[model samples]
Target chain A: MSPQSSVLYDAPGPRTRRRTTIAAVLIGVALLAGAYYLVYRPLEAKGQFTAVKWGPLVDLADPNLPLVWERIRLGIIATLTAAALAIVCSLLAGTLLAVVRMLLKEQAKRRYAGLPAAAAYALRGLNTALRGITRFCVEVFRGLPVLVTIFFAWRISGISDPLWPLVIGLSIYNSVVIAEIIRSGMEGLPRGQREAADSLGLTPFQAILLVQLPQAFRIMLPALISQLVVILKDTTLGYIITYEDILAVAQQMIQILQNPIQMYVIIGAVFIAINYALSQLAAYVQRRVSRVRAHKPAAAATELAASEPVVLDA
Target chain B: MDVLIDNADVFVSGFWLTLQLCVLSATGALLIGTIVAAMRISPVPSLRWAGATYVTLVRNLPLTIVFFLTSFGLPELGSNADFLRVPGLSSVFDRLGIDLPYFRFAVIALSVYTAAFVCEAIRSGVNAVPAGQAEAARSLGLTFRQNLLSIVLPQAWRAAIVPLGSVIIAMIKNSALAGAFGVTGELFSSGQNLTSSGGNPIIPVFIGISIGYLIMTVPLGIFIDRVENRRAVAR
Candidate 1:
């Protein structure tokens, strides 16, 4: 670090400087030695650091390599398809959940407003029941690991598509998370938005659907994209169930090719690339949203009718 | 339900193992994460670059890849099993009653992957510590380490409570993946075993397993909320 210290603190005194220099050198040496021990030396001992292990990967010129690429292409397709299905399903499920949770609270409020003798009692019962069910679904799905959720879906899933289990599992767990994101986004809006809707003669439900939700969903787009990346990553879990996705394909090929390290590296890099592209797409969309909102603030509500994805805080 | 009762031992142990994995991994993650967070906020440029690179690389990668590296990849190269036998570590493992090689790999994978998230949380927490606090510490003639350890980290952790809680809950859910890699006596594997064993009625087994997880995860979440609320009120 430069001795040109910024506002956080002044440059270290002579003793402090010597101590920091010694500490930095020690940490640097430790880092280098740790890397060598953990990565370089062990792999070298196993002959994994040699060209023999990596040469096949470098020979992209071979004509027969297209067959291997074909399997990888298919695996990538399967992984993406599963992620797409899960993302769609989760968004639908999450919006429904957020709305349901909201209505449950709203129903409780109305229950005490003296609607009627029989109807109030029925509504009370219904509200209590709905509240229990919603809370259970949200908490259980949220609390359960995604893999276990997938395991359950795999066991029960009777669909023809082999990926149904993964899709269902991802949707259930992520929707709970997504619902929280969307609800929090709405909750974050200024109370003035709702008061304006009320003054404009919109009912609470209409205000939620038209005014609050649209705004929240817009603000939530970036977070939603990040969650989609998570879903994409979890698609690798499909390997456990013997799903022939990209990761599974790599695992299978690694056995035949005897290049586990190289295969997994390639697979990991593929995932990183795809996810990085998705993140960039999210950033681009965020910029576009801001641009549109800035250009014509009045038309944003109408023009943004489509449910752009909602973002989570994470 | 009958399946659940018949395999109560499996479910109970699975819950225990999952809980053990979460606790150990969360502790390891917190330690590693704090160091990385310190590196991130340090005055050293190289340290900051190293920290940033780690967060970027690991955060973008799938946890499954991490699990693969530790479980399958490491074993392929050589054995780190001897490290587990170190007196201090082994006795801790003995107390936890988890001896499987897979459990060790799971702990390594889960903690390493989780540390990236935890580092981000803590770095943000560090950033949230008002600049004035550091200035005040400097004015008090405290050393840089003193400023960080005494003045900064305590408040950083407070700022980090919610995100760190989410990371812990996420870690709990994530520990279930250890089962896929042949970590016996964990929730996911136990559920998987029920199916392969035949005539076990798999749906209820998994529902039971999810409930086992909820037993661990929900309480942690509620506890974090209580802590956050308490911290807020104190401030």
Candidate 2:
């Protein structure tokens, strides 16, 4: 009904308006009937809608409610702990890998001045080899499914603690993804960012560390937050390795309560709530970043400083 | 190495199932996604809200939970609503010799989950079409559907191809979850079975499995990059 959406068609006349109302009513009724038949009736017939089935999770008067909450609280703490560890590890490793790969690429392209010809050739070979190795690792990690990576970590790495394997696996895969995100962010910057750094007499490494990376990170903050949500979601995979995360704990509760549907619904709701909040934050940050870039370009440095800690808190 | 060479058929069949899951799920996602996209942009406010609600709910829920709901929860609902039991459709699948209900459930889960991403990709594509293009089409006395099909969607599809490819590639990776949830013979479960039952070395079995996924994903990655680069050049 907005003017913007109306761009696709003309404003409705009286006859068109009547037709639209009739169509909308019919569609809405059909949708309601479909939902009733597909979801409500089936669930009702199965006794899933009974208060007894939902009492453990929702009813305060239930005797087992406190114990259930305790388990869920601990499960949430465990999931967050793993997610935090993975987020920290991946951010650091991803930044390092991105910088090192960038440096190695520059090294491969640069001529070694005032060096022996043989030494220069050998250095070039080393640069190329390092770059190749870096590329290989990134590709391999990015290509493999995170579950397989987690499985490998759990099985082959001799890590007895379930949390470490989950953390290590998530960190590896997510670090590679973050590195690519950072690399693309840097690439998206105007050429002047690099040229200005060079004109200021900074070495390639120093320029990248001091100048290019900060801007890239700032530009890619929304992506980084979204990836954090991914890490949080993936921590649930620890259930496979028996890691006592929220989902795993939910399964344990189901054994005693015999309410798999209620438990999973609660668990799913928790995840959806958390992830939806994170994604909304990402969208908010994206909007703010673009606004900051658009207006008052001169104050961007201070604005960037102000915004940094808010994202890091996640 | 010898382990992989001896179990070549296992790996082959595993990857084949993975490929089939991807193809079927991708098709379903595309069909459902297109309809959702249409609904999201339709003139009806209720339809728009419905589309938005669907995308938000599905996108936020983890795929594992979606799989759990479809595979375990559907059966518990006691509905005789087997989607494959439609009059003529069951016969087509019967002819193809693929009749695992769990496999069908996995496909349902995957298609439903991945369709959210596909819907977002298409909406982005629609946004990429200029306002003037739609206005021009409307001024020429074209209906909304005609304007969308002739003017908007063609350009949108072109703009959407790179993102759609990435979505498909992600779906391929996600199909790994199907193996764990009970759809056997996929790459992940095959690796799991080989290591656990066959007593093969975990490293080699996993390595073989990773190779199968890379075979599916890496080439697609390259193709996406090439298409993206070509688009950039065209622009």
Candidate 3:
């Protein structure tokens, strides 16, 4: 409202103000009624609100009561396990892909200077073919839903554990998105940094490693974390292929308890809790990075950040 | 290849249904998303809170989980089926021979999922509107709604087309999840049927589907980019 305060309409006059208040009140009431009818009434009618169905929740301390706590506990571990593996793999894969993409760009700008004609010709052919392959892989993975990739990977991976399929699927898909984030992050940096490193006799690889990657990683931290949260949420897709994740446990409970409402609500809450924490960590990192960057008058908040690369998850 | 040819009908129907779910839900998500976006920018605090809460709640949960809630939970409410049995409504579905229950919940799930993303994109668009434009609208004595409708949103939508198109592609991908939940005739379910038909067709079948999706999505991205570049040039 501060920047957005339009001078177009004056502050509503008393009558108009009253009308706005009334309309707001009506909307609030309608929302409440809509929620009650759409959600509450249906739940209540099915006896889902009753203590007997929800009673198992409170019996955690009672040793006599059998519970799926162990499964749920294992499910949490499994989800984290998949997320951790996928995060590492995607980061490595993304970095490699980003480097290759940068190579493609550099090759396009190649000058044939200081090279043998045959060597130059070979490099050009290799560059085009490499570009073509990487571009297709990235586009295919990015275009297809992660769910389909997971399904395909699960079937064709021919691995014993379902875990490998989910992790690989999540990695290949997310690596493309993360690569974009990395590439954009590097592009946003002042060319001066790399040029200065080169003037100091740093090799291109040394300049990139010592000077550029750190800056790009810092700039891309917020985006990287969001993609990680995407990876986290995507582990739920593991459940569809019957991977032992939190969602699968939640689904299993419904068959036993006949409480899809309560079960799904519980599952949804767990996901919200985990994802909220991850995003909060991301928010904290962004704030810290921005604060430090602000101290140095860095133009780190580039327009590239605004072009959010869509996260593809399995 | 022969496996693909043999199951050609299944793939066709699946692609058709995937397209249907994608289009319908994208439309629904856009409408509801616009309203939610409006609520966020409204002068009223309560409406803003409601809009913010909806986005947070929906965006935080995965679409698969949302589908689980819709397909499993909504049916427990019983009204979903009862509504289909309503006097005049049941007849329309009957004439069309659509299984109202599964289709309704799938659409609901997809809309409920995609709408949060659509809201974010449109809200970003709203934010992108120059302050001067809003000021100009206000100076001309335009009401809040009038300024939004006539001045801000028109510009916003143009800025929004690319992001919104990305959301549509994501929704198309997500429709495969509905097939997971027993919604018949989408690529995921068709792939499942093909798999059970035996011999690692899961590879060829889903690879074909991935190719199908790429064909659908890549063109969308290109078209949007073309328009976006043209718009930029015009500006």
**Which candidate should be chosen as best, given TM-score against the real structure?**
2
lDDT of 2 at B42: 91
Compare candidates 1 and 2 on TM-score and give the better one: 2
User: What order do candidates take by TM-score, descending?
Assistant: 2, 3, 1
| Fnat values, candidates in order | 0.46, 0.52, 0.64
Q: Residues B82-195, candidate 1, lDDT per residue (tens digit)?
A: 464557665655523345577777888888899988987876667667778878888999877788778877987887887788888888888888887777768788788888
Q: How would you encode candidate 3's per-residue C-alpha lDDT over A1-314 as one tens digit per residue?
A: 42453333467789978887888898899999998998889778878888666655445655423566666778889999999999999999999898778768766768687899998888888888889998888778888888888877888877868999999988988888899788878877888887999899986677777887788888788778878888887888998887889888877776787666676677688888888787778777777776676666445445335234333222
* Backbone clashes counted, model 1: 5
Report, for every candidate in turn, its global Cα lDDT versus the true structure.
Answer: 0.77, 0.83, 0.77
Candidate 2 segments whose C-alpha is farther than 4 A from its true place: A1-4, A13-15, A296-314, B79-81, B85-100
What tens digits encode model 2's per-residue C-alpha lDDT throughout B1-235? 8999999999998998888778878888999988998898898767888899998888888888888888768887673236645566545443123555777787788999999888878887777778899999998999998998999899989878877887888788888888888778888999989988888988889889999999988899899899989987897
Model 2 docking grade: medium
lDDT of 2 at B74: 81
Model 1 C-alpha lDDT per residue in residues A56-116, reported as the tens digit of each score: 5656865546777788889999989998999999999999888778767766877456576
DockQ, every prediction = 0.49, 0.50, 0.56
Residue pairs with clashing backbones, model 1: A220-A310, A220-A311, A223-A311, A223-A312, A224-A311
User: How close is every model to the real structure, measured as TM-score?
Assistant: 0.88, 0.93, 0.90
- In angstroms, give how far residue A142 of model 1 lies from its true place: 0.4
lDDT of 2 at B119: 86
